[model samples]
Target: MKKTVHVVGAVIENDAQQILCAQRSPSMSLANLWEFPGGKIEAGETPQQALKREIMEELDCVIDVGDKVEDTTYEYENVIVRLETYKAKITEGAPIAKEHAQLIWKKRIELPALEWAAADIPAVEQLTK
Candidate 1:
């Protein structure tokens, strides 16, 4: 059986109405694809909690997590991913791409122009609507 990984993604929007997107590093599984910045849910953590921790680790910023955005389950070659995304705002510090190859803020309408990871596509659609 393929392992199912539970992960959380933060769809962080700034006051400018732009969304933050992260590019997967070359060493990462989905290299060069864009995604919301977040990581796997650890034991004893809620989805919100996981997102906060992940944003701090991956982007070096603190965020105020808000409503659930999208929930998707996607099956890849070796694993199944259950991705839970939430609306968020950076409460402190600017985002610095600590783990990802790059980070950029894009308008909702422009989001589709980038190639996104499969698991993140649903949330991207939801935000674009």
Candidate 2:
């Protein structure tokens, strides 16, 4: 039986209409791909809680989770991920690339220039619309 991982992602936008994207660490599974800042859902944690914790751990910032936006499921060669995505607003601390290689804030229209993760492509398409 294949194990499914429940992940949480945040579609965070700033006042300048730029969305936050993080480059996966070169040592990570999906290296160099741009993705919404998030991580796996831990045991006993809600999706929102996991999102907040993951963002803080990965970016060294605090964020307030907003409305639930969308959920998507994608299958990788080794495992399936059910990603629950949500809108989030920064409440404190400037974001730092603690886990990722780099970070960028991009206009929604310009997202095509960055190479995004295959699972994240659908979410980006939905956001661009």
Candidate 3:
């Protein structure tokens, strides 16, 4: 049976209205692929809390998780994942890429041009619309 992994992502926007995107590390499962920043929702944590913690841990910054953007359950080649993405804004320091290979800020129109993770495609389509 496939375990359903619950995760959260942030559609973080900067002052320039550019959305933040992250590239997976070479060692990660989806290496070199672009994704919204976030991680799994650990035990006893709400989706919002998990997103905040993930952004802080993965990007080394703080964020105010706003309204949810997309909630999707996708079946990857291996694991099945439920990804909930929220609109967010940085409330503290700038994001520093410590785990990801790189970060980029992009306009909504440019979102579809990048190679986004399959699970993130729904959110990207939502953003681009």
- Location of the lowest summed lDDT over 10 successive residues in candidate 2: 117-126
Candidate number that wins on lDDT, 1 or 2: 1
Give the residue spans of candidate 2 off by over 4 A. none
lDDT of 3 by residue, 1-129 (tens): 888899999999999999999999899998999999999999999999999999999998999999989999999888999999999999999999999999999999999999989999999999988
lDDT of 2 by residue, 21-129 (tens): 9999999988999999999999999999999999889888889999877788889888888888888988888889998999899999988789988778877888888
Give the alpha-carbon lDDT of every model.
0.96, 0.88, 0.95
**At residue 14, what lDDT does model 2 achieve?**
88
- Which segments of candidate 1 are over 4 A away from where they belong? none
* Candidate 2 local distance difference test against the native: 0.88
Best by lDDT: 1
Q: Pick the candidate with the highest TM-score.
A: 1
**How many clashes (backbone atoms < 3 Å, residues ≥3 apart in a chain or on different chains) does model 2 have?**
0
Model 3: CA > 4 A from native: none
